[model samples]
Target: MVLAAACTALGLWQLDRRDQAAATVSTVQANYDREPIAYDPSLFDTYEESREWMPVEMTGTYDSANQRIVRNRPLNGRPGYEVLVPLRLQDGTAVVINRGWLPIGNREAGHPDEVPQAPEGEVTVTARIRPGEPVLNRSAPEGQLASIDLAGYGAQLDYPMHAAAYGLLASESPAPATTPVAPAKPAIDLGPHLSYSMQWFAFGVLLFVGFGYAVRQQYRLDHEDELDAPAPVRTRRRPSSEEEEDAILDARGL
Candidate 1:
């Protein structure tokens, strides 16, 4: 019973995970390629989960001085860093932009080989909305960050910032001489959670089925043992002495 309960709980947990994954896939499908809207500062005042991956356009200049490299970001199985630069909009509010990925450097142990610079001067950028990442509480070298914790990044900046969310660069006009590898699109696969949930549920059922089968087999064996046992034997009583003597006299006379 304990094992069955545990299996059932695991199945339910997997189902919950499946639902969450499905929700993410739905969001990507709904927003990934939708028409780009002009950047609205109020839209980011409190980040909306449903708006993730929604494209927005804005005219801004990259603040290269406060640019940060996010450590431990890997792409296509190679270790790398993500280049993050603040894009100062016309309204004086800034939003962090993840330009792309850069491979780790051979000369330096932790730094990237070369970070492609963002285009200089005023430019128009099309970027996908992304919520700020949580702080990992991990440390990184100078000029680098452990995670895309926008709030923490904003704290280091000298100007006001939209810390609730950031942007995944889609495109920029007046392109730079070179750019890092672009981020890959989000996978729509629902993963193996559904199958895993079914397995766990089946296991729970099989536990009881196996237990019942063993019980039935035991009962049948006990019944067969009783039927195979021999029956009790009956004994005859000895004849009386008087009756025996009369029989002997009659035989002598004859």
Candidate 2:
């Protein structure tokens, strides 16, 4: 019974995970390729979960002096980092832009060999909105971040920053001669959570079914032995030696 209860709990947990994954997939499907809208300070001042993956366009100049690289970002199984440059918009407020992924360098142990530069002058950028990640306890070298914690990154900058969200680069006008590899689209696959939940549920049910089968077999075996037993037999007492002698004399006289 204890094991069955545990299995049921685990099954429900997996189902919850499946529901979350489904919601993520639905969000991506709904917003990933929608028409890009102009960046609105009012609408984007605070991060919204539903606005994630929605494309937004803006004109800004890249602030390369304060650019930073996010450490420990891997792409296609290769160790790498992501380049982040603050884009100064027309109204003086800046938004952090994640340009793309860079491979680890050979000359340096933890740094990238070369980081592709963002366009120098004012350029139009189309990017998908992504909420800022939570700060990690780990530390990184100078000019590198442990994660895309926008608030922490904003604190480092001297200008006003939109710390609520960051942009995943979609396209830029007047592209640079060389550019970092673009990030791949989010996978809409619903993973194995559903199947795993079903397996756990089946295990819980089978536990009771097996217990009942064992109980029925035990009862049958116990009753069968009792029903097949032989009945008790009666015995006559043996005659005494004197009785035997008297019976012999009587038989002769007869």
Candidate 3:
């Protein structure tokens, strides 16, 4: 009875989790697929609001001269570096674009400065919305640019200024030379988790039933031993032969 109740409860709990996950995925998909918006800093009230999959369009020119290569970025599961160039918007707002990965070019060859600098002209940039990195114990290296402290950087930019900067960008300019064309978000299914939850519940139920069966079997074995035990033997020592013969003679006549 207890095992059945536990399994039923667990199965119900997984169902609830499945519902919640589906709801969350639906909300996110809806937001991402909603109307496209031009990059307006004021549209975002907080970092969390901006850290989502929304289409962002901006009219900006890349400042290629100030480009920096962020080391250790992986794309398509391959190790490479991302080209980081600043985007100078029409309203004079500066946003960093994380252009896609490129091979670490040879320093001796002119390829050392391999990625091209953005030409000084107006260009359009479209990318997914994201937030600035949070403050943490680790710090970026120095000399190439100022140390990377997200909070401090945001403070320097002034809260009301530019919105959040994302960690990755598909460069949309330089005539397909440097721009990365963004791909649609991949579809993810959560069905396996629900199934796993059911499996765990079943295992938990079996635990209870198996334990009860084992205990009952042990009790039966102990009871049977007590009921079928052999009668205790009354073992006695034998008398000496000479003593036995003398007792026989006295009984006969003497």
**Cα-based TM-score, every candidate:** 0.86, 0.86, 0.62
lDDT of 2 at 205: 97
TM-score of 1: 0.86
Candidate 2 runs further than 4 Å off: 217-254
Off by over 4 Å in 3: 1-24, 31-35, 48-51, 103-113, 142-176, 180-184, 226-254
- Estimate the overall C-alpha local distance difference test score of candidate 1: 0.92
Best by TM-score: 1
- Candidates' lDDT values, in order? 0.92, 0.93, 0.59
* Model 3 vs. true fold: TM: 0.62
Q: lDDT by residue for model 2 over 1-254, one digit each (tens)?
A: 99999999999999999999999999999999999999998535788878899999999999999999999998989989999999999999999999999999999898999999899999999999998899999999999999999989989988899988899999999888988899999999999999999999999999999999999989989899777789879899899999999999999995
| Per-residue lDDT of model 3, residues 110-141, tens digit only | 12246654546777776666555545554444
Better of 1 and 3 by lDDT: 1
Each candidate: how many clashes?
Answer: 0, 0, 3
- Clash pairs detected, candidate 2: none
